[model samples]
Target: MTPSAVDLSALGQRSSAIVDQAGNLARYGMDDVAGAGVRSGESVTLQAPRTVTFPDGGSITYGALDHLGRPTGVTVHITPDMIGAGTHANASILPPGWSGNGILHNEARSHLLGRQLGGSGDLTENLETLQQAPANSPVMSGFEGQIRRVVEGGQAVDYLPTSIYLGDELVPRGITLDAQGTGGFDWYVRC
Candidate 1:
């Protein structure tokens, strides 16, 4: 399909899979993806996203989310023209299943991802708030960030379909300590 004639719905649905909160991305970590490897081992080096100005005098950006759905280190690439939500900008959400290293990011990409870090599960998603976009956008990703966006051009669209997952596994928070003091046991409680 021509870039101009791109079906916002088709594209949005094709690429939006933000649901499944407890997926692999949530389990090990998005950064652990081969391409988005951490700077070090198992240490999260998430990036704080900031909007960049498109050549057409507007702004555009993308980001990733931590297990808690918080924005991590990443940025979606913006085409010089159609990549911003400024006062005079036009935008649309690409469908789900359309992950290319070009202008969009997949769950594995270290650059940008769209997870709903904050929002009412039903509505009032935070990603939309950050972009100052319409709630009905096809690129908002629902809450899991399935694929949603709002355009200044005033075309009606629906957000990409979304499904969230929950990880029931929990890790015990603990600290091991050993003391060389006169305790009967060599590894007695230090605290």
Candidate 2:
């Protein structure tokens, strides 16, 4: 026979051991507690947003902010099924599946998930700060729109995709797709 009432205190104590964004209660395999399940030598999967062309002809795409708790490279998946088809049961728009690597070796940055350079600046404040700055300032000129504010290692790390690079090439800072294989992932370097 077992105790009629189970003790949940142990589980409660370990709650901080993992993060549950969607309230999915289950054990996830992740080595580092700080880094979700992502780290160097680890593979991560992220869900990317749809890519849309802006009025200025530049395209805007959003995706995986972080894996575990570190900056990561993002991957976009465009499969036939993922593509949008006019079907009631199917997704109205193509859903992008973004995979990411835990480690960020690229010097270039991806603004997909950037934390403000300041300790407490958020998107609104960062934008406001740029808005109040002189027109000649980089932030005033345009960095505001390209940068995203996110927290990493308890500090804000602004991610800028346009600045991402591989070696010396301006490539996606996160991941770049191989030219030979569309199915392959590429860092967001500006190559």
Candidate 3:
């Protein structure tokens, strides 16, 4: 009953060639519950069991974009070895609804899984348009720092950062940060 790349397409917009290309890159998690049985606001875990590891050791999975080209959710396992060291140089890829002046004004091309956390800066599937206030504020940075600290200490953490879009809006209303570390760390940061 896990959600495939195509099954996830039904949740928002139709699948496109771009979505297919992104799906091919990351490993997707299957839905434990039937899609039809899912109710609004109910928690849905769309990943396979934790024992199912990625081939690259620390890999990320980006759900296909909705028909509107908005990001759905992004999942990644953060490990110390996978953290990137240099400054992030995002490739020339832009997320949906990107504007040089910002879609909502002051919107930033945010990374759901940051480059420091092993997310690809150039990957379109890993980017989203997030409000600059929260995206650059201490709240977001603090949460990411917590995850980085935990992982750097040699603990493995499973992180899922989801962009919460309201209705058909292209920009996310907020982002829900979920992380669980093997070192007895579990937290959710909604910003």
Candidate 4:
């Protein structure tokens, strides 16, 4: 099936808001996935499908919801026009402070360390504590590698989709375009 063009600008704007909230929660050792008002694990069939527009006249249409009936994910079909010049690859479209690396460290990893060390008094102390802390600490083990993969972005981690998946059925995420204009990267999401 032919993929449709999605406006990166519009998706960036909308996703930025969602990521901002998610990031804040992550920083505090929390996740919107289980917050009080969040929908936990509802069936995907109940949610309505919607079209997400981009600033450059691109758009994606899909329906997604988490367990709690809140929008959780989307599968966007990439088209030639969606990868136009000036479009960002993924979370890169978010503001500078929202880089995947930053979020991994400041939010996910740091929070884990804080719990392990009982809260260090300063950044230096925190680093020192982490340095002195056991390498096998449960919280610090797998996350660094996970963050590295996310920041690097390649075949294992791409923003564009070969297909679209949403809801409970595991639809493809992001956009997919013909091979001609899709030279460098596959796809990207805003942090």
lDDT of each: 0.23, 0.22, 0.57, 0.26
Native-referenced Cα lDDT, model 1: 0.23
| Per-residue C-alpha lDDT of model 1 across residues 1-191, encoded as one tens digit per residue | 11011122222212111212122112222222222211222322234434444464433333333344432222222222432232311123222222333233322211122333112122111122121122122222232121222222322222111112122111101111111112121111100
Q: Comparing candidate 2 with candidate 4, which one achieves the higher TM-score? A: 4
RMSD of each: 20.8, 20.6, 11.4, 17.2
Sorting all predicted structures by lDDT, with the top scorer first, yields: 3, 4, 1, 2
User: What is the lDDT, from 0 to 100, of the residue 148 in candidate 1?
Assistant: 21
TM-score of 2: 0.21
Regions more than 4 Å wrong, model 2:
1-42, 69-191
- TM-score for each prediction? 0.20, 0.21, 0.66, 0.23
Q: What is the lDDT of residue 39 in candidate 2?
A: 26
Using lDDT, give the best candidate's number. Answer: 3
- Rank order (by TM-score, best first): 3, 4, 2, 1
- The candidate 1 region of ten consecutive residues with least summed lDDT is 170-179
Q: After superposing candidate 3 on the true structure, give the runs of residues whose Cα lies further than 4 Å from its correct spot.
A: 1-56, 85-91, 102-104
Supply candidate 2's per-residue lDDT for 149.
Answer: 14
Query: Which tens-of-lDDT digit does each residue in 71-90 have in candidate 2?
Result: 22322222222222111211
